[model samples]
Target: MAENQWSTAITSVKPNEIRVRGYRLDELMGRVSFGEAVYLILRGERPGAAVGRLVEAMLVASIDHGVTPPSTLAVRNAASTGASLNACIASGALAVNRHHGGAVEDCMRLLARGAARVAAGADLAAAARALIGEEKTAGRRLPGFGHRIHTDDPRSYRLLVLAREAGTAAAHVGVAEAIVAELAAGGKALPLNVDGAIAAVLADLGFDPELANGFFILARTAGWMAQVIEERRREKPMRRIDQGAAVYDGPASRELTQG
Candidate 1:
């Protein structure tokens, strides 16, 4: 390696071959799911089938949340102005700030704090309570505990169940649950939201907190594309993009057929 040359361990490109984390990209195409490939690329190792399934579930859970979300609105608004697909998608991605799609990383850090206290001989409930007190004293709101629309988030419940089934529900999951319990005991009664559930699962799965929000961005990209395409196909150019005014006129609820 020379001082003027940069290096990357993420991928290697040659004249006739491409490799990601030392595995040939072509070989990984059919042998692994997208979630498995993501894990392999990020962690530099393949995950078991169950873990891969859990990852895929997490992605599915966040694929869309309708037009009211800031990202979706941004996409639609940009598209209505006749923005290119890439630009519209960029608009959506830019909307994923600290309040919108960032709860995953924030909740991961909160869980880590509680987990560390538990590891240091504090009781789980006590640790959670202490964390709550600290955040209260700092006048900071607890992230990932509540939702504006959902009293009990279905995605949270499903993801937690899948995490347990995948054997990845460990310290962080326990801490998250303990926090929710403590919140209820304190009369707040905020249920764990999907972001919190993902945070716990990813923390237990040994992912870096900094990378947590990337999962949300990746999953929601599909939804952004859909919104952009719909805007381009159906809406008038330069129309006002009102988030709350939008109504669903799509297909009725239908069950998936069994294979």
Candidate 2:
């Protein structure tokens, strides 16, 4: 490409503009924080205050779900197997593509669906059970309600409790809490794991259900890198073989047989 062709084409801000990318920094500065800026960059509009803050919190919270995170584990596994940098990163993405990394978003959808019923005073327990039943009928696994880790994700519960105290949309917070309590009492002790917590807090704050998971994927990518870093430090990554295709009788499975 021509030198600075794109630079000249895009200049939203000048030196005195105090801009980001092209926006005037001074004007858009307090109008939105870094979190809002993030939204603006990705979606081209500043989200509402609640949304901005909640999205930021979700982003901050999405990182490093310990080494068990498949992305992290994939990186480590790649390192152990002697994968290339690209391959290692690819592994991380592969891991996230599965449900493990995307559960928060799935949970968000469940909460929103349940939220309407809860708002109508459908009974929190009933709402949860109904939601789970609906999901089971759809042949889908329920997302954010349960956790494999904590008996009760204390962090999520604590955040929900605090969000309720924050002004505006407190009822949504209550609804989220009620759903959590109902599910916890009925199902496994899993009380609002990370996904559920993010879903509740973001939904309460007014983020779209999808944004919750996208933000999580963005943050979890870092954890993947962290694993790669650790693996690199210990020993270079090893590319993992797709065991499904490993051929044992390459010679015996002759051209005619292969064809």
Candidate 3:
């Protein structure tokens, strides 16, 4: 927002138009599906139609899941207390932190490393094992391989199924399957959750990992905007929800006298 400031989500907020990374919207329209456009916007060029369409569809599929999503719940809470739509949306987005949307980026990093090892002629399973080992050694869970909610995340499985059905490659799809399989072989059922599958599919299509978060945020933005708009239409704000400030429980100290 300052002079010379820019973000790689690829936007020029001039001429009353937004060109995501220099490609005009008009040129992208109909020529690419929403997923391809998303890929192009983030990566600077469109991938093949099949891959692009698959990614776009994944984005669309995740837009919103009723009032259950935290963002939507935050918007609703804001509406209940009489807050502006934008304010409600900001509040909601504030709640989604490193723990939530961060997995895709982490997962992609692991895959990139594992893929490199595999490409260098290491066995695929061995590379995956090394990847998991490295993450554990770092005191973290292997990202993109599991979820907290589902015994095996059905949402992820369904999305991957659809992406594969839409002609996403077997190899990329196999990466996801292999991760799940490897996890299972360890006597764990850490299925490929949404983040892992998304990472594998996107990486297969050649998008940079830097674009991963932006692509995810774009999809999340739609859901956020929709909830914000809905809250706006409801004509009430969540004054109570935004009322309280933090209760400090840190160390208390007596005032020090200057010597």
Report RMSD (Å) for each prediction in the order shown.
1.4, 13.0, 13.7
**TM-score sort, best first:** 1, 3, 2
The estimated TM-scores of all candidates read 0.95, 0.69, 0.71
- Cα deviation of 218, candidate 3, in Å: 1.8
The lDDT for every candidate, in the order shown, is: 0.91, 0.66, 0.67
Cα lDDT over the full model 2: 0.66
Give the clash total for candidate 2: 12
Q: Model 3, stretches more than 4 Å misplaced?
A: 1-24, 27-31, 66-72, 158-175, 225-259
lDDT of 1 by residue, 1-259 (tens): 7879987899999998999999999999999999998999999998999999999899999999999988888889899989999999889889887677888999999999989998999988998999899989999878878888898899999999999999989888998899899989878999888889999999999999999999998999999999988888899999987778888999888878732
Off by over 4 Å in 2: 1-22, 25-33, 42-53, 80-87, 119-121, 136-139, 168-175, 236-259
Cα lDDT for residue 146, candidate 2: 64
lDDT (Cα, 0-100) at 10 in candidate 1: 95
Model 3 Cα lDDT, one tens digit per residue, 38-150: 66766677777666668866686556655555556665676566677667766666655445654677777778787787778777777777777787789988777665565
lDDT of 2 by residue, 155-221 (tens): 6765665455444344445555666665567664446677777767767766676566576667776
Better of 2 and 3 by TM-score: 3
